[model samples]
Target: MEEAHSSRYSIHPGSTKMYRDLREVYWWNSIKKGIDEFVAKCPNCQQVKVKHQRLGGMTQNIELPKWKWEMINMDFITEFPRS
Candidate 1:
């Protein structure tokens, strides 16, 4: 478990991923709970844990354009085949 959690290849995967990877070759009662507890206790994991929260609130309304070309839209696409 320690090697799988801290090895260079593993790199401290979150409990879900760790559980998935471990279950491929190992299984036991309460394994998911164990992995969750392990990750929760890991200082490294705690340090870099991502916070799950709403990214952006309600979108603000944009002012209506009062003149031609006031609001311009463009799209750029690369790797187009030439005719």
Candidate 2:
């Protein structure tokens, strides 16, 4: 995003084809990079005025468990008698 955004200010704006060529070289047809997505969705690129979005309620993410379910499953099997 920084490169794309900076390109906007660079007076070139992907004019040199470096970004596009590099995309074709490394990404090899996968078109979902965050920077490309950002540039594609840029209001400036679309020539549309940016609208302010209202803040939405934030949702907290659940904490990650320290171990995998497979490990816990083995423990559960050993610790519990047959039901």
Candidate 3:
């Protein structure tokens, strides 16, 4: 399990993919549950897992410009001479 999960070739696949890969060569009762538990306990998986929840707070609206050039955005990069 550790080899299939954490090895350079596998790189920590999620429970579903891991189960599919492992089932071809190995089988055991309650294997799905075991894979799920193993993935859930893996710290590397937890750190990078995508969150399914909505982002916090409401979106704010930007005000429309009332006149020409009312709102201007500029970015400048200047190189200074080194002393």
Candidate with the greatest TM-score versus the true structure = 3
Which of the two candidates, 1 or 3, achieves a greater lDDT against the reference? 3
TM agreement with the true structure for every prediction: 0.60, 0.28, 0.61
lDDT of 3 at 80: 69
Task: State how far residue 29 of model 3 sits from its true place (Å).
Answer: 0.8
lDDT of 3: 0.92
Which run of 10 residues does model 2 get worst, by summed lDDT?
70-79
Stretches off by above 4 angstroms in model 3 are 52-83
The residue ranges of model 1 lying beyond 4 angstroms of the native Cα positions read 52-83
TM-score of 3: 0.61
Worst 10 residues of 1 by lDDT: 47-56
Of candidates 3 and 2, the better by TM-score: 3
Per-residue accuracy of model 1 over 1-83 as CA lDDT, tens digit each: 89989999999988999999999999999999999998899998887765643456788998889999889988998998999
lDDT of 2: 0.52
- Would you list the rank order by lDDT, best first? 3, 1, 2
